[model samples]
Target: GGGVAAVLSFGVANRLFTEPRERGRTIGTMGAVVGIVSGGGALLGGALTDLIGWQAALALPGLSALAAVRVLRIAPATQPRAERLDARGAVLCLALAAALAVLLQARTTHLKESLVLVLAVLAVALAAATVWHVRRVPEGFLPRLVVSNSRFVLAAVAGFTLFAGYLIIQFAAPRLILMDHDLSVTQIGLILLPTGVVSAILSRTAGGLAHKVGPLRLVTALTVLSAAGLLLAALAGRQPVALVIAVAACVSGFSAGQVALMAAVPHLVDSSVHGVAAGVFQLVFITGGSLGSAAVGGMVGAMSLSTAIGVLAVVPLVGMVAAVASALMVKRQTQAPAPAAGPTARPAVGAE
Candidate 1:
């Protein structure tokens, strides 16, 4: 329910703001709110767990229900589309995510080879089925319209790697800090709190920046900044300054990258598919997060934490390269001479 609800914010932004800068600014404000809330929640949940029972932290999510009232009040007026519900596709998606989660973590965690092989086969089967279903029912789960747009697909891929690196730093950093400093979870949370405050401001700044600097360039630079953070962690995580840089970089990357992508989506695909496009784009990237977290958990026992983080840097580094390539390609295309069009020439997508 939360995941479904999460996707709606971008869709609403897309509907409400047609201009790129305005939408970017709106999404940045939204991202800032998320950063502050989640950062505060980390501290609150940690305190609750330490001061009271672990179960006390469970109440935090119940507080989230209060937001639904606001959601109802502000969500754009929307009508239900009458398309067939993609039940099979939805089920396959859940199954595939679960299977892949298990399989990815199975390796360095030392699961029985036979069990790993079985889960591997199951994941492959589920992934195959999902692809077949999406292709067979293009208008269903993943929508042919959204998938066909190269910009949309590229943005999704960039988002996935950005999140993968972010989560890797998140999962890896706290454990390393605890191991090194023996800090309480609450203290760690407090130490990280500034990241949220700073990132919130930077994210909001990114909104205005998007108007002057191409969003793709900002995104690529942010991704590179995150990868560099991980590299610093790999090299000097024991140092206080590097640790702060590591945590702050990844958090900023995700917060600002999300704003950039959210604003870019309306320009990537038709507004008609805005809702689904935002949903699928989020799912892909957040799923990358899950994998990154799993990778750290699976590999920590088998390798040095620094080595694990260095390995993690590769994910976002890949994203940075893709982002750079995409920006260049878009620039070249933008500069190229327009083909002579007949009466039916459609305006380019970025014109929106």
Candidate 2:
């Protein structure tokens, strides 16, 4: 998805710039831009669909894409030419992802379809093969250098947990808003506005706090807060005022924590493979969101709405465990003395 692309680009750009504070500001601005565009699109699309046909409404975005291509063609290349494209690995990875996507669609949307299981199994196999191939192949799809770092692994796990919690809440929010409050889509967006706005405003500030208090601690605290928020939302379900506040708390905390994560991940990784590390982090976060959406969607479909919301809360609880592990790991690694590079020269006891 283009949203995934945009966020990945933001991560890579932060790595390239190597300025933490500026990266926070840039990401905040990007978030603001996204909020505006998404809000506008919702309103405009609704209007267009109501006035004209849905097909005609879709044509507008197609026209916009044509204009976007022209703009992109004129844009200057900032990256070095030395970067080699891993064509085979890329194709294999994409194919595996496509298969997984199809399987998910079939399982969720077309339950009667028997081919989903076969596709899912094939997808898993292809993905495993892709990973194996990449490690052996020079300039493969996955950047080998990035995966070597323990920090990258930690960051990815933390990112996964964080996004899982956030997306689960996101999937549940609209249902709660519509069913509990009997609000229109427009009203729901307006109610959600404060959460997004506060998050955008606070993220840079959160980044600053993270710099002072450390991302590991900030992330842990935020993870706890996110879980608490979700629990509160679950308890406050069908209660209009409390539900809104609870959802706001969940969204704002999760988003601010993401900014802190982006800032910390690059520094945690080896400098030589920073770009690839950031890319991996982004990919993990996106994949986690997908999984979270699926998990939440399924729970909502099968169980009661309150149960779905409560189950979603467990995602952030998992995030708390990850955050605590990451914090302890970082502390242990940071505090531990580095081994001497060479054998220490022994001073003769008599000479001393």
Candidate 3:
């Protein structure tokens, strides 16, 4: 599921648009669709689970997949290219994910100490191997140009960090609500519905604004808003109304920030490498989400859920700093003068 999403996100966005303005609009529209589906899915799932059964609710995603087949047929195909599969990189990534999952389980559950130690060692080994492999290979799994680009790196960091914060909220909120307020699954879904709606609206608007104000500026501002929302959620405690407002703000900001980062991808990398760049970007984005959910879940097991959520709020502030740094880098790159023409340079036809 993760692999497919990463591939499709990069392939579709890269193939569909070239110019930044158009890309922003397209990416925004994509975000809106995702927001709708994600938000609506919760409501739909709850209704299905109540009316029918858990099995019926689980089947709904398959139906949506069948519907998506028609959309897939309309997608343009790319020219064939001879590219080596990065099998070692793929294995290393999977190992890392598995090890991380085990470690999270160890932290949250009463697992044997020896098992936890072994998993920790395995996770460290996988991380070291992935880094070494990337540096060793000429044409590595990730493109060198994409990795070296400061703006792209910062954007990736911002995306990962912001998503982590968002996922933490999603993981912790429902549990907190149920524990404190005794809300049913359906009631919890309803409480969270507004967040998705606001996110969908902001995501589309942010895309157009990214073209006008620049993605970094918009992302930075939105990230700060998200941070503020997290802080509010941290302080809200058991207040249902406050929690709803905070969730809406956080989701809206996350949606906008996501659109801005994605819309900036084409501008950051060459057209030819968009597919690879997008894949790397989404890989990190997805990894952040997993780490966020795991880390916060573990923390909740160790301490009060409210305290864990409060600490997790700091993640988005870190993302805001990365966004600001990206904006500064963009400004510097823009202001740097073009190299002076050499003697052999062709003269302008209209030279005075």
Best model number under TM-score: 3
RMSD of each: 3.3, 5.4, 2.9
In order, what lDDT does every prediction score? 0.78, 0.66, 0.76
Identify the runs in model 2 with alpha carbons over 4 angstroms from their true place.
Answer: 31-76, 79-83, 91-108, 341-352
lDDT of 1 by residue, 230-327 (tens): 89888988766678778778878887888877766655678788768878877887787888788877777778889989888888888887777767
Inter-residue clash pairs, candidate 2:
none
On lDDT, the leading prediction is: 1
Clashing pairs in 1: none
Full candidate order by TM-score, most accurate first: 3, 1, 2
**C-alpha RMSD in Å of predicted model 2 compared with the true structure:** 5.4
Better of 1 and 2 by TM-score: 1
Q: Residue-wise lDDT of candidate 2 within 68-117, one digit each (tens)? A: 57646654456675867787776786677567555544534656556776
- lDDT by residue (314-336, candidate 3, tens digit) is 88788889888888877887799
Model 1: C-alpha RMSD to truth? 3.3
